[model samples]
Target: MIPMPARIIAVCNQKGGVGKTTLVTGLAEVYTQMMGKKVLVIDADPQYNTTSALGLSGPEFTLNDVLYGDESNNQKIFPGVAADAVLEVGEDWQSPNHSELGLIASERNLASRERDSMMAREHRLRIALKGVAEEYDIVLIDCPPSLGLLTVNALTAATHALLVSEPRVASVEGLAEIVTTIAEVQENLNEDIDIVGVVVNKVRKGRKDQDVWIEKIRTDFGELVLDPLLPDRELFAKAQAAAKPLKSFGSEAKVLRADLEQLARAIWKGSEA
Candidate 1:
């Protein structure tokens, strides 16, 4: 029997530094390790932070290569396990669980390839991902912090989107931009695409202002906002610096691990809804 096709989810927000990469990387780890689902991570950002965080060196073939077929001779270049592979969510992998996370590693050259023909934009990522859809249960795309071609490609390819925002004034203001972009994409590009829900990240615990914004977002968006917020934790920064996921940060990561697990379940169930 054939495997079910993966659910492609784009973790997107127009604002930068809102923990988009962190959520994508960590969720991918949890989905695979805890839930036993195979996962693929697409680093659509040219910065390749997700690529490096996952311990993959700059690969010759990025989404650009697959988009333009520029490196047609190197289409098979998937992420390979590196020595520094970090996250340890399961007993199966003693080293970092890089192998468990399928990454289409990016490089600096990806920036130049963004200028490809407009017609090529719609199906670039979808076409590339089609070949590997059977390998994983889910594909989480780490979109760039802008609504450019890279983001357009992600939106077009995804079945749904996970919007990440912080409990900040600026991040709240940026939510409108994200909603507008998603609307435009659904109208003009991919009709099947939907906003899965908004994820509130980096939330400050017991902050009055944070509570106010959270309620405002929920009231405005209704059920589009998910429950169980990701708190602002120093461990998140430490995990980034250590090149590991929150789940691998040892005992300090327990609460975070539980939260992410709940988040994963929400994602799975939301997809069904």
Candidate 2:
């Protein structure tokens, strides 16, 4: 059996096009495949890209059902309702290991819940996953690219936060805002939530501006910046496109896979720098 009270990590970025969704699915895959953890991915984002990348298509019970309850069954946020929404991934891919991966998928309708004026809106996701989270060793929340209610709900539920950014001025600039948001969440919502590290993703080697931005990120964030920078690779897109494991791409995917595995290790170990 997996450990009780899973380490829930909210993979967040306030800016779009920074590959936040990609990192979520990649880390989920790593946690399950390399580290042998029972993983549950909560696609809190409305776009639901992470849901699709995980090979789940048109799931009937999604995060929407978990948050607002499945009206068809007249089920509200009761104990284990979130578990009811979870579906196993990679059954079609025929990988026994991938079978361990579970997901509370997302759909476009999830976006509307953010504007929900109901009381205790930020606590919805937390309430839904109470008993369900303990079934997995790791729970990764794929937050939307905005510091909105959805992101706040993810923060309110998470035990840790992993900030992902590209080596660009615009992307790096948004990091401060997200950091501030996390701080706010700690002050008001979930005080136990901590930032594990900052992942500088999609680095283009030898690009002058990117080099400068990466340095700035390290200088500003200090030991919080995790190492083995993720380079801009087509393999990430390819593997995600096929809904296949990164290692399945063969020899060409070795280095990137190793990097991801190492990164996953660092995150799970709660290492800094």
The lDDT of each candidate is 0.76, 0.85
TM-score of each: 0.86, 0.93
Model 2, residue pairs in steric clash: none
- Highest-scoring model, lDDT: 2
RMSD of every prediction: 4.7, 2.5
Indicate the residue-level lDDT of 7 in model 2. 88
Q: In candidate 1, where is summed lDDT lowest over 10 consecutive residues?
A: 79-88
Error of 1 at 268 (Å): 0.9
